[model samples]
Target: MSGRRLAELLAATETQTPQGGQAVSFEPLGWVWLKAGSRRRRERTEAGVTRMIETMRVETRADPRLVAGRVLRFDGDDWTVVAVEVDAERPGRVRADLERRP
Candidate 1:
């Protein structure tokens, strides 16, 4: 996925409870490779999982200065990010892959 999408996903995967309950974290299941001559496959890794969780946290904060992307993924849909791995792109930018069930 592109950096824009990743930023969007990260911003959407987060939610705030009534009184800011234990921040729920959404970890990336894995990436499904869409190959040309073979069936799709998924490769899960710790780094991916970590990125998923961190992005959620970064986007779900109380700061209103953060900018979130428009990329979104619904539940049951397969998605992954290859580039733009982290949410440290620039100031006031929350990097994330917005793949969460609303």
Candidate 2:
């Protein structure tokens, strides 16, 4: 897949209790093909709440696993999906807005 990158969609695949506490494990749904996206820094102000957000715009084939609040592993980092939008120009494709998790 030229002009594309690969990322693992992270999900709460399993759960368990350790020491009477709850814990979860995020497992990879599978390797997915992603169109080349960029790492960007954005500054926004809403209701006087200004913040700098590091974001990524990932374009890929429409996958049911690409849901908001889900995590994606790529480039050795985890990114949280902020939003998903349809790719009007490329039907069957979608653009996922992601924010880097610290």
Candidate 3:
């Protein structure tokens, strides 16, 4: 797809999921599936950064085909989840930095 097309798609998705979305579980290098209407978790730094920390919700799955990873597929678009850090307290949520893949 063209860069413009991809950008448009992401923008649409962001609007649809303003609260963010859920990221299914997968391995470090495994392919992941991401969809809209998932969930979003947010946090705010009381004094330090003075900005809210937002992240997408992620949940693990027993089946290998359905879990978390650094790569995600959504709406026929592929995105790479970079700087993915798991929440120490919440096992189901992950702080994922998303970037377009290819």
Candidate 4:
């Protein structure tokens, strides 16, 4: 896809700061595309009881500054990035699995 199309799809702005050992701060990184993935439920045993855990995927451009554990504000909601994967075929794209912040 063309960069223009990609830019148009990237309607959300995200802010993140370099991960330092101490305090956490954020700086705007401009607009980015945010795509939601399908919902998944996994059964897990916790405290001797079965529970269902839910997760979803979120895709965006390949931004070097974005990393796991960063809180992203999108669509008036806060999402925490759990994992990041770069698309080998499309070097400029990236996929991130996000979980809604509680």
Candidate 5:
């Protein structure tokens, strides 16, 4: 089967903007293309109880404002930026791990 390049993969994702308002403290940054990479789930047992933590891994264009501890609104939900890296997989893009925030 034929394979696709990194630029092609990044181009496939749709562009979106962060809901810049009182919800976010800083000024609006550049547009980001969100690509749903994967979902991670971890189970921890503590005090005879098991807790499940879920997070989502997404890829987007490198943006300075998209950093850890920032809450971003997209797809009708708010997701907190757990971690972010520049060109971890390829150049000109960023990989971010997010956790759904209620």
Candidate 6:
């Protein structure tokens, strides 16, 4: 799909050197058009507690800098990227699977 819709902003976590120590910061990558979907799944943690997790599928234009750990903000909600898959047929597009962070 053409990137004609502005849906979300991609933010990357950056480490900055400030004062005598390092600090973590969120840097805005850019605005991107995205197609999104949601599903619910049950996840078991290390403590053996089962919890419901909302997973989101987000598709957008391909960006080499977009990785699995970055955060995506859309519609006042933040989702963490869990996987990124580049579209094989359409080389300029990428599909990122995301999970809502508790």
- Candidate 1 yields a Cα-based lDDT of 0.32
RMSD of 1: 12.1
In candidate 5 the C-alpha lDDT for residue 9 amounts to 16
> Which residue pairs collide, candidate 3?
24-67, 25-67, 25-68, 26-67, 26-68, 26-69
- Least accurate 10 contiguous residues by lDDT in model 6: 1-10
What's the true lDDT of residue 71 in model 6?
Answer: 78
- In order, what lDDT does every prediction score? 0.32, 0.80, 0.39, 0.61, 0.61, 0.72
lDDT of 2 at 46: 75
> In candidate 1, what are the lDDT values of residues 4-94, reduced to their tens digit?
1222233335567889765645543322212111113333357556322212221322233233433334333432332222336445433
Give the poorly placed runs of model 6, Cα more than 4 Å off: 1-25
In order of TM-score, best first, we have 2, 6, 5, 4, 3, 1
How many clashes in each structure? 7, 0, 6, 1, 0, 0
RMSD of each: 12.1, 4.2, 14.6, 8.3, 9.9, 4.6
For the record, the alpha-carbon RMSD of candidate 5 to the native fold, in angstroms, is: 9.9
Candidate 6: tens digits of C-alpha lDDT, residues 1-102: 223335545666557576666675667787777877655565747577767677867788887767888877776677788899989988899998878745
Native-referenced Cα lDDT, model 4 = 0.61
Per-residue C-alpha lDDT of model 5 across residues 1-102, encoded as one tens digit per residue: 112213211111233447643332433343465777555678767799987766787777777777787755555555668899887558889887877523
Measured against the true structure, the TM-scores of the candidates, in listed sequence, are: 0.22, 0.72, 0.31, 0.54, 0.56, 0.70
- CA shift at 61, candidate 6, in angstroms? 0.6
1-102: candidate 2 lDDT, tens digit per residue = 125777888886445577776686887788787875677887878799988877878789998888998888877888888899999999999998888634
Consecutive 10-residue window with the lowest summed lDDT within model 1: 30-39
Best by lDDT: 2
Model 4 clash count equals 1
- Write model 3 residue lDDT over 1-102, tens digit each, in one string: 211111111211222344587444433334333332343345556668655443433333222333233345554545544454555776665444554423
**Regions of model 1 farther than 4 Å from truth:** 1-13, 19-39, 47-78, 84-102
